[model samples]
Target: MYINGSWTDAEKKQTMEVINPATNELIQETAKADETDAAKAVAAASTAFPGWKKTTAKERSSFLLRTAAILREQTEELAEILTAEMGKPLKEAKGEIGLGIDYLEWYAEEAKRAYGEIIPASSSSKRLMVLKEPVGVVAAVTPWNFPVAMITRKVAPALAAGCPIIVKPASATPLSAMKIVEAFDKAGLPKGVLNLLIGSASPIVGELMRSPEVRKITFTGSTEVGKKLIEQSAATVKKMSMELGGHAPFIVFEDADIDAAVEGVVNSKFRNAGQTCICTNRIYVQKSIEKTFLEKFTARVKELQIGNGLEDGTDIGPLIDEGAVKKVQEHVADAVQKGGTVMYGGEQASGCTSDKFYTPTVIADAKDSMLISTEETFGPVAPVFTFTTEKEAVERANHSDYGLAAYCFTKDIGRANRVMDGLEYGIIGINDPIPTTAQAPFGGVKESGIGREGGRQGMEEYLEDKFVSIGNIE
Candidate 1:
């Protein structure tokens, strides 16, 4: 699909094979875009920028809502391709598309809500106001794990804010993102308003970030990569919002419902095989409940069925690739050597050699000294440890260099509030596993990330502010 105002054959002949990790086979293929194609896409976006930016908020909002409808209508196709291309469970993939649609619809309505504030002027003839405007051309880079949703989370708002966008989706899973762009085109988005180039990140991203026409960037990926992006973006001094790596802390209080805590950790940690940036990687329970927490969590972990993502009722799917599998294994082995106990599903599977499924693992007696508890494992490994007091739990959760989302369970409202306040991470939940919502802000502190991604906060990422003053000319 040629998104940059025209449908022309790609310049390069190279291509990327979309591989299904579940079966380790090629699913589909697309031309690997060269730097020339990247330039064409940005140029198309630059040409469209003047008109898109000049569009009234109401017109932009209407087009965004139409795009949302198009996304909803094509969700099934999007989900099937996501499962085939990225290896997420079909059901979860479907849900991810739904979330993508919701983000667009949410932002469509939000466009109307955008307001200008009047600044007090010292004199009657002098007037001042602050206005929010789209940040010219946006270069959005999204990861593969949650391909469809992450793209929508960034692209939807930029369009809603009246910005022409140029997207660079992950090379591993570009099909799902491609389908989304197809949806936008079908929805009749104006020419060059939304465009994308897929292939080598070095060629695509380097050129886009350095382009004078590209005014801002919103990225979701590794912290190391994000740091590099920040440095590169400095060259143009472009606007940037980064959602990087995370080491989420899942804390269980003694007063918590043991069954609920076990279920919460298993569901959130194993979903996507722990590929999420905010997945619960560290489990810190009150010393009194640690014994009970491990017993229940481990039992549940053993019952999960690992299989192909398309299989009905499959609880777990393959890691994105061999690198993720190796990383999870290394972390587990390191923890075991450091006195960690594997009560269930710790070893890699040899029985299913053809498949890429890594068993959901439960580690007990884990400590901060181990890599599993300190690093962002980014796999289906949940390590559990004990804490003596509120102060201790807070300190333990904050010990990591990365701080994204943190979770805690307690019926005591006061203690829940305290945990919410004391935790150093960006997003926190009390008795709730998923803290992300369309109405509230989501992001991280420290190495986890630099800015928020959801709710009203995300809209602000794609926009810039300007102040206008009118003085008396008497």
Candidate 2:
């Protein structure tokens, strides 16, 4: 655990063993934090906030820029540690590191651009102005998938906006978070400005929820947990940002380029072995091109090599644990039982070092009655559903409670605009599968989430507005 500018153990000196999901081997034992440690971190952040927020924007920008430089210098070492702990492919892990660097660099510039406003006065002797100030101390909870990217996305903006933060990363992937904090500390971050706690989620989060010192909480994880946080934190009325579960729908219209659509679906659905919050969950293809799309898509999925992330030429890695494997199996069985056909690779992968590996699976003629249709499988399984008309496709895609992300592939410009408008998701990709970038707002609507990350809006999540009115301006 890292708290108040130093690496320290929990007050009780407890530790938790971290296991590599791919090989099921013990990697290292990390310090385990409890409620007492959480309170100490909160106190530290609160103590640091008054001075930290007083620094000029340019001064804050310099610290963030320096940290980004350090991360860029140690990309390879950090990437390997991330893959070893998180089970993402080495190349993908490197890409995540690069993305983290992008966020830090982007927010460094945004630090200087948190613009305030000057409003017209009602009288000649009066002046009205609004100022942007840091929202005191923040507490962040990040998920296991995309460990580096998730932490950077939340922490970069917090630091750039001049807030002291305490991060509680998922126990499954604490090393990546620890490494990032180490980089910031190496770059000369001030004491108590940034802190990290690793341990059971209940005690750490419970402390965060009950502490009135923490003015903001940013979380990226499941919807169930997000709700619990909301319920617990209602007493303090802390500002909260929640990026929760997503059940994205991938729609391929008949006019879409079949080969390009196939490639896009494969990239969107299977990257990180289908565990991403925005990955395509249900693939809908027009009846006219259904057969051609499935053939090419299945071929591409078959070519994905599954093995330990450290091994060369490995594309897909193991699920996070045995329970993940069991969830995939259960979804497949339920789909097959409800009139879905198993196209290929629908069993536990053989010849792998552990039982945590599941073969890439595809199910055809999928219906909404199946478990895979409504629930997020969070595995390498693609369930294909066909539609006859554009209206039906849009209607079906907009039916889910989750409104995080949805994708549509079509070459028709007019139809593309229509479909893009019709979908209810927060982020939509038309003819392009991967649409996330540092310059655009990324979040969801409805039950998916509450606030946005990325773009100029991301920094706003950590800021508060103060309106000042001055009289006798003469």
Candidate 3:
């Protein structure tokens, strides 16, 4: 646990073990903080809030810039830790580290742009001003899939907005979060300005929920847990932002370039072994090109090299754990029973050292009734479904309760525009699958999530607008 500018343990000296999903090997045991520790961390943040928030945006920006520099200097080391703990390919792990650093650098500049506004007054001698101010202490619960990136996504913006924050990373991947704390410390961020709690989610988040001093909560994970947090936060009425579950729809229009569409799908769905929320959940290929797309897609998917993340030229890595593997198996089994045909890979890979490996799978003739269509598979399984018309493609894509991300591959400018406007998701990728960046808003609509991360809107999530009216102003 990192609290009040120092590294400490739980009050009872409890600890939790972190394991490498690639090999099921124990990495290390970290502090298993409880409600008491949560209270202390929140109290520390509350105490630091007045001083930290009073600092000018430029001063905070400097701290963030320094942290980014430190992270850049240690990118290789941090990426190694991420790969060892999270089981992402070394190349992908480095990319995540780079993206995390990008967040810090982007928000460092954006801090200076948290602009206020002056409103026109109706009466003479009256002035109206709207000021953007920090929303006080904040708490973040991050997911394990992109451990380093998720931490920076929440923490960078909060710190830039001049809010003290407590971050509780998923228990499976706490080391990456801890390294971030170390970077912030090296950069001399003020005590309590940023804190880390490694433990069970219930006790730490429950304590944060009960504390009135903690005014905001930002979470990136499943919708089910997001709902529970919403219920708990009702008592405090804390401002909440959720980046939750996503069953993103990837569409290949009849007019799209077949080669480009195949490449885009591979990058989007197979990257991270299809564990990402925005990874294509249901692939919709126009019936005209369904046969051609599948033939090329299957050939491409077979070329993917699967093994340990640490090994050279490994494109696909093991699933996070045994449970993740089981979920993938279940989804594949259910889809097959419901009439979906396996095109390429389906069962677990034989040569892999661990049983946590599941071969990248491609199943055709997927239907809405199948389990893969409704639930998030969160594995390297591509269930290809076909659509007949533009209307049908749009309808089938928007049928899911989740509206996080949707991708469309179309060469026609007018068709691309139409699909972009028609999709209900918060983020849409036209002819591009990996569309996320530090400068764009990343979030979802409806049950997928609430509020946005990244871009200018991200910094605003940590701020509150205060309206001031002055009368008798000379």
- Top candidate by lDDT: 3
Instruction: Report the lDDT tens digits of candidate 2 across residue range 17-98.
Output: 9999988899999999999999999999999999999999898888989999999999999989998887989999999899
TM-score of 3: 0.99
Error of 2 at 365 (Å): 0.7
Predict model 1's lDDT versus the native: 0.84
Q: Could you arrange the candidates by lDDT from highest to lowest?
A: 3, 2, 1
What TM-score fits each model? 0.97, 0.99, 0.99
lDDT of 1 at 175: 87
lDDT of 3: 0.94
lDDT of each: 0.84, 0.93, 0.94
In model 3, what lDDT does residue 220 have? 96
* Colliding pairs, model 3: none
Model 1 misplaced stretches (Cα beyond 4 Å): 353-355
Off by over 4 Å in 2: none
Per-residue error for 329 in candidate 3, Å, reads: 0.9
